[model samples]
Target: MFLPTTIEEVKKLGWKELDVILVTGDAYVDHPSFGVALIGHYLVSKGFKVGIIAQPDWKSEKDITRLGRPKLFFGISAGNVDSMVSNYTASMKKRKIDEYSSGGIAGKRPDRAVIVYSNLVRRFFPDVPIVIGGLESSLRRFVHYDWWSDRIRKSILVDAKADLLVYGMGEKTVLEIAQILSRTRDIEKCKTIRGVVWWSSKKPIDCHELPSFDEICLDKTKYAESTRLQTILTDPFKNIVLCQRQDSRYIIQNPPQLPLEQEEIDNLYLLPFERKTHPFYEKIGYVPALDMIQFSITCVRGCFGSCSFCALTQHQTTHVVSRSVDSILEEVRILTKHPDFHGIITDVGGPTANMYGSSCFVRETKGQCEKFCLHPKSCVNAKTNHERYLELLDKVRTINGIKHVFVSSGIRHDLVLNDPHGDLFIKKLIDFTPGQLKLAPEHSHPKVLALMRKPSVELFLEFKEKFEKYAKNSGKQRYVVGYFIVAHPGEGKRENEHLRKFIEEKLNYHPQQIQIFTPSPGTVSTAMYYSEIDPFTKEKVFVERSLKLRNAAKANLMSLNSAR
Candidate 1:
């Protein structure tokens, strides 16, 4: 990159000018991921100038050219999980569509966007640098085992053309990068960031000794090549590898964080976070911000459910943790002060809807937690606490200017049933939710629920019945909808027929809000599709997901015989 020849001569830097620029594919408004507004607040608290370029029309050749360069690093993204099925022709069309047809791939190629931005700055001013972070950069850290494409793809570092690829939990990584830059350290020279996948000093760095997440699953058949997959590819793991292109084929990789102590995870998120949650922007056709900010917060990290088809515990590491209630309530008090803020607090709780102050970490050791917390099945030592959640809810509900406090996030049936307080939590949720009650009973079959590490449909229904009765006796019939997945590779016609009958018999032929399993990367179910094996029981499963059945299920859900 050419050194900026004119920055010294033409510009005087101000705090705002020196601020970091966050450009993301996801709408920055209240986004749960980047929580750009929130992150921006933290940066400002740390005294870094920050700006956001949300969902840019990168289809234009000049998209980055016009932004010029940031005196600080540029944060780039294209929404949470960059691999979106672009064209909106039909829900089923995501499969039939390719990049040419899928507008999702049309945006600025990461490498090109980063390189051009850096280069353009070099041309005019020359010495400025650009760094890329976000899902697009994180997921691209390795020559990934792409089960869908059936091959390892190039690292995103090579594609996005950024100096480095910031992977995994970026909160600490991004800050350290700025410190290095502030010390005039050549970014390319800084190779030790915990989550960095970078070019190793003129040579491709190699990590022969690094751990592989491929081992996380106890089952080997995920590689069987028979199972159809949808949605996610592997459970979240710290195993990441980076190729060094500067010289020889050197590489860098990292093992996932040792299961974090509960206190560590809690303290990590509790750090004086400046509230950056977005105020809703009433823009039409614009990407909606993640809606990260809420009247209340829950589950800072850790979920130990560890289902073969899930990554909730994998991604965050299943050691359920939470932030201090004092910090969270403080944000509500501050947000309520805004005259425009609704007297009715919007967004009460989540990150699994109600997993606050959970997780059993060993003060004695990082001791990977035992599963079945609050379960009669096994974990006699499980650390279960629904009162913590209830306490948080009560505090938020009682906060002044807050009227209706709801659990806007989908419910975790496992956790809900574990604590009687969970039942109370749901009761309060129903009584308070002015909008909708969302729950995910992902499938109807007992076997499928077991495979997904979720509760059985019967169990979900039992809970639903209880909630319904509570609401009815009290004279409230707001809706509590279940999210179901169809066409999962393991689900075949016969299994689906059974599912339909089950729904019809139990749910009165009511169709659900159907979601065709679109196996995404970074998920356990995705691996099963790639290999067609149940990592747990060594059982073989189907590999293909049924779009037709899925569509029919959805069509059935939205219609009522009375409406017809």
Candidate 2:
């Protein structure tokens, strides 16, 4: 059921007051894919009267107060994507549309939506506890660089003046916090919870102290060192409390919550969601974001691929947690019964489609592995297989109401190339996937790819050859599409030239999703972009900071196939 968005809905639920009120930048879409919906629905199932205020007007208290102040606290999220990334393009220009917003209109949310909403909530209800989470807060939980402002910023908890910040996938943290606050009604007491960050008058004992906010802003080397330390401390078990001083108080981030077990994640996905935007938003028109995922499925959480530019690892952790096949099949069955059912399932994958059932056995036995599973090279301890996922796809296809099931989320080509039964897997994918398969071979230049923590281009080329051969043998004329990033930390005009040449000469295709790198917070690539040095080796790396140079790099790729 959709959480109460208006006083009328709240009344209909027979609630005179709510225990929690969630404020988000996106329209209220009661789908599992949306954090607000999942969190809201989960809270409701737990017997808390939860209300959601979606895309509230930031200019005043009118919209925020619509659902009335919560008895426990206000949960503020900047929707699915970070506000800056959602509102502005990589070029720092205002975006024309917000997929998460109703009618696909932009500017529904402010630039720093979390901070804005938190501050707004504080203004009206100064005493109420305000907790911030979601992509914007999780990524910037510590002192990090802000791309839009082109400068170092204090931890989001400090800037937003929020009482507590829930980092990572926040289900466990939020539930714990809500439970604690319900009994104690003390925000300060919620500090010890894993996956929660808060400001402290004094630093906690035996914590990892990062460089002070002022020091990181002034010293690039210190910034790099801090970034390296932060990444190392993301392990749920080994991670100690991380404290960074912002002036007088210290921002204390507790260790991340352990990755949800399979049953736990499945339960979260299985929550009773309406799977559509709240009817209140129907007047504005259907949300564009829901159109894509309404029929899609999320089979996994977390990622093994530790791409430097991606935030999946930092937020969801490098460890993978997958749902059971029966649970996934149940969701598919429900989707097929929907009135808008088209007999087509958009996707069935997670961080990386093929990494579905694969996990590091060492993590299960010991604890969080310090190094990533598939960065410098694929870890031998990491269980790399596609059989379970392939079997799941076959089961989904055989369901009574299902027709075409595409793995539209894309696969890790390297995983497919390395699998012992990869030949059969590729043939299955050729039959299951749509006309074109999506893959991200960010750059061809070895140094560039190395900085991004991606496999070498040769691996991708080998996979392409094998996939094409398999497709041809199967009488399929399918093609592979690639996602590349320009002006990434190490990529200069020279690297871009090499990338262009490789695509034309070797791959014999022009890339379509070529994007200029946007330095998002809490990412290794963003740290490198800010420090102009590789975090691993502390070696000076070429960084293209000039807007014209960045645009030129993108234009170079854009020119390809224009005249073809």
Best by TM-score: 2
Q: Residue-pair clashes per candidate, as listed?
A: 62, 0
* Candidate 2 wrongly placed segments (more than 4 Å): none
User: Over the stretch 1-564, how does candidate 1's per-residue lDDT look in tens digits?
Assistant: 010112331143333244466665444444233444445544554656556555445445344444455665766554454444232212434333223111322342332233333344345444555566555455445433344344444555665555665655555667667777767657764466655655554433443322122422333453332122111221123233333232244335343334344454444444444233223223233232323243344445545555554534334445454667776676567667755456655555545656566555451134443333432232544455666766777788788887766666555666677665666766766766664566777777766766676666767787777777778877888666677776665776666666666666676335546666655444557656665676435687776544466566555544544453
Q: Report clash pairs, candidate 2.
A: none
> Could you tell me the lDDT of residue 319 within candidate 1?
48
| Stretches > 4 Å off in candidate 1 | 1-16, 30-33, 57-62, 83-130, 145-152, 199-251, 255-302, 307-314, 362-378, 420-429, 535-538, 545-564
